[model samples]
Target: MKYINKKIIFTFLLVLLMNGCLGIIPNKDSVTRKDTTTNIESSIYKKYNRHTDTTYYSHNNLFGKNISIYWTKKKKEKSYARIKFSYLGSRWIFFNEVTLVNAAGSRISFHIKSTDISTNVVSDRIVSEKANFLLSKVDIISLKKLFNSPSVDLRLSGKSHKDYALSESEIKSLFEILSYNP
Candidate 1:
């Protein structure tokens, strides 16, 4: 009887110790990770994914509108900038032309290679449309050169044309986004 009690106690103690060790060890899934990367002076936000080895940079609320600029690059892929313009009207504006005018009055134009359109119906009478344009490598180089200036103006043209003068904040964010080597 004593032997049985001792065996039971010993088993209980062993199990408790094992559980204690498990509780002390941190779990891989439970470990908290920082979602956003460190901030730079330009307020450009970046997020990195360890699994895919990619980095994404984005800036929101550009041009006094809800426009957003995004840049992403994978480990072995070329980086590209995607500019999304939000239009409040219902008409479709398939923007295919992009022009950047620097503060020095020099202009660089780019024919958009990739374009996407998405529309959202807010109400029975109101609809919102978003158009996305991808900038090419040469356009990016021109943007890098124009980054030295104080501001840059952007123009998008399709069936119609719209002009946007980039604010100083927008220019700063673009400078940082274009300044990266990779």
Candidate 2:
């Protein structure tokens, strides 16, 4: 009978100790992860993956160099273009000049801009080059001119950079989908 009483006391104390410890332990799921990869000054890690189900565009022998592009809208609610390219010992913009020409002969140039997105890099290779070029709603509406024109052209050119062109067919195929993905 005495042995049974001691066992009961020990069990009660153990249970009480465990309950106290539970309150002191931190819960990982309750904590949110801070985003540090995005928003860097003059760094490749500034590009982050903002899109889901990315679509790729590439052409061989585009001015004697391989030119490629990946675009989508997922993480970034803003209208942006991320270019993963190699030119002039740089891993950012592949072309020095980019323009959109409408049938009315209106030529709109795209100025490369910095973004808060981040891309991981290791050693000397860019693992991910996700540069975000924000496109505002007003800007997209203006693009309607190029889309509705009889002939739309996406002309890209640069020194040491790959010069490439996207036909009307290519622009139409991606514009509607990439521009509006809610």
Candidate 3:
């Protein structure tokens, strides 16, 4: 009975190893970060699971004084890109829309899915708002077009609006952040 039990345990471990359920082996995905010359910072990293044949992409961007952004997608989720915008402010702005303007004066719009607000009590009271945005395939294509433009500007709107024109360095960082592929 002891010999049979040991054989069963060995078989289970071998099966787990073969199926990558053991989680002991290192993954082969390479993560790359681009050098930024400007105050704006951005990076994209990919994590690939060989056993399940799935790729996960992580994109992070930090803009000016108060806005930070992260975009992510899994390989199987072809139609949607999940993006979160974290804004630090005194009160909720309730951002609902984002517009991208290329150098040619053309504009593309993305509708934000939702916004959530919270307050933090620190040395100074500050309100933090997180806006969730979902980009469809069409929006992604429009973003690609903006990436090729000489300059880009971002306009975010809700109860209030904020506009930012990308500097050369910021534009370069945004380009690099969006260029990553699985």
- How many residue pairs clash per model? 0, 12, 0
For 47-145, candidate 3 gives per-residue lDDT tens digits of: 667776666555433332232223554556642354444444445567777677888988977676563433343113344555555666675566666
Model 1 local distance difference test score: 0.59
TM-score of model 2 relative to the true fold? Answer: 0.38
lDDT of 1 by residue, 68-88 (tens): 567888978988787666555
lDDT of 2 by residue, 3-49 (tens): 98887776555444432322233223321112212221111112334
Q: Could you tell me which 10 consecutive residues in candidate 2 have the lowest summed lDDT?
A: 36-45
Candidate 3: list runs displaced more than 4 Å.
Answer: 1-43, 46-56, 59-80, 113-124
Best by lDDT: 1
Error of 1 at 73 (Å): 3.5
Candidate with the larger TM-score of 1 and 3: 1
Candidate 1 residue-wise lDDT at 115: 36
Where model 1 places Cα greater than 4 Å from the true spot, the runs are 1-42, 48-53, 60-68, 75-86, 113-137
